[model samples]
Target: MSANARTVHPLGERLGKVLPPLMVLGVVVAVWWAVVVKTESAIFPTPWQVVTGAMELVEDGTLWEHIRASLFRVGAGFGLAVLVGIPLGLWMGWVGAAYRTFNPIFQMLRPISPIAWIPVAILWFGVGEVSPIFLIFISSVFPLIVQTTSGVHTIDRRYLRAAANFGVPRSVLFRQVVIPAVLPEIIVGMRIGIGVAWLVVVAAEMIALRSGLGYLIMDSRNAGNRYDLVIAAMIIIGTIGLMLDGITRLLEKLKTVRWRYVR
Candidate 1:
């Protein structure tokens, strides 16, 4: 293709990605507004009402506080999950005995809903920030451990065999090859973990804490049916969740990990 064509093509691709979503969002909002108007919703909020509600929160300074609290909790919990899970997963993946011992326990715990642990979290950590952080860690860490372990299992045997043939030290082989090879999978796990963590933190905040977006929704509801604020909180939660996912996706573009992300 010509240079101009190449330039135009990428611009087209970007627009292709962005425009459809924008169009769909517009249609959804239009329909939402129309429905609210027709139904004369005493409780349901129109798009503009949600916007106004958001602005009200912004004006009162509570919006940033709630957003900051939620982000901080997610960051802390997800950080802990990464630190604990990745190393544990790598060890379990490499050592047969470790895998045999730990796999059953994690598998048993994995299927339980994080929400179900709210009582236990509250009991263990009390109704404080630690409760939600602990829940987020619990919710996020499992997927990372599972994914990283699976990644190690699936690493090409030839890589290991070739490293062995070359007399590469066990430590060097693990550091240079195993870690790099497993990074893509680690990123995948992180993506899943972060999403779950965000969800868990919000839920924990709603039930146990006073300061996150989740609490904003619950609080808005109780304060004379402020459904607009409720919807605004919901939208903020969703938008931030998407942004977190996108940030995780950017890690896939790292040179060492990019090879595994085949189209």
Candidate 2:
């Protein structure tokens, strides 16, 4: 084959991967711009207006401040949830009595929307970073626990039997077998938990804090009717959430856990 022909296939493959999404996004933006123009509504911003608004925030350093605050809250809360949830879930999964005792409360609380806890969070933490952090933690922890528990329950019985037959100590069995078996589920839960944490933090920040992307959206609209900035904040929030999920999804690439993610 000619060198040009060889190069064309890989280049075509790359374009095939990228072109469809770009076309869809272009269509959406075109539609959005057309709607704004046809309506002639001053309130709804054009895509360019939103871009300019984002630029303004970027120049003023407000965007970074809000992003930093939001990221810190998510990281802290989600990190804490992972630390507590995994061990608790493992114990509960291993012990039927613990599972029975706590499962009811988990189910009860899990169904309650994280936003519903805002007032209680405010009352308990008194309008500080703690309130939002607490809210994010609450939103994230349950999923981790539930997924981890399910991972443990679904583990192959033969693996455990073999471990026992080999005279593996309880600690070694858990360290070597149980943890490895459940790590995939735990990573999945982490991806879910981080998304929830990102979602809850925005809501919490809107209600409980003076800073963060949620507050930026609310404050921009309420203070100056800045719909462009409101949309910009939303875009930033969504982009960051997607990035966090992507980071956790990378865990699935690990050789030990790749089977869980492979189609």
Candidate 3:
């Protein structure tokens, strides 16, 4: 293709990728506006009202504060889960004895809702910031552990045999073979964990803490029945969650991690 054709091709592809989502978003908003107007809903917010409410918070400088608080909690909690969960999962997956001993326990704990722990969190951590952080950790950690363990279990046995035939040290084999092989799944786990962390933090903020988007939402409701602010907060939460998942996805592009994805 000519240089001009090449440039136009990519530009056209970019627009093609972008326009469909924009078009759908437009349709959704048009319907939302129509329903609010047709029903003469006083409590439900129109899209414009939600935008205005968000702008009000923006002007007051509270929007960024709440966003930052929520992001920080998710970062801390998800970071801790990564630090603890991945290694534990690796160990459990590599060692049959460890898996046998702990798998049942985690399986039981994983089924319980993180929200169900709010009362216990308040009792133990006492309505402090730590309560929400703990909840985020709880909500986020299990998926990482499960996914990482599965990743290890699914490693090709031929790779292990080849390493053994080469007299590769166990540590070297783990570093060069096992870790790289599992990275895609680790990224997947991180994506899931971070999403859960974000959800837990919001719910935790709603009940136990007094800052973040969740608190902004609750405060807006209790103070003035501001459904617009509530909707805006919900939108912000979803947008941030999508952004976080996208960031985790970018890790799959790493040279070491790309094989599983590209193939």
Top TM-score hit: 1
**Runs of candidate 3 exceeding 4 Å displacement:** 1-8
lDDT of 1 at 241: 96
lDDT, residue 42, candidate 2: 89
* Cα lDDT of model 3 by residue, 102-207, tens digit: 9999999999999999999999989887888889999989999999999999999998999899999999999898999899889999999998999999999999
Which 10-residue span in candidate 1 carries the lowest summed lDDT? Answer: 1-10
TM-score of each: 0.96, 0.94, 0.96
| Cα lDDT computed for each candidate against the true fold | 0.95, 0.92, 0.92
Query: Which is the better candidate, 1 or 3, if ranked by lDDT?
Result: 1
* Candidate 3 to native Cα RMSD, angstroms: 2.0
Regions of candidate 1 where Cα sits further than 4 Å from its true position? 1-8
Residue-level lDDT tens digits of model 2 in 214-242? 99999998987999999989988888888
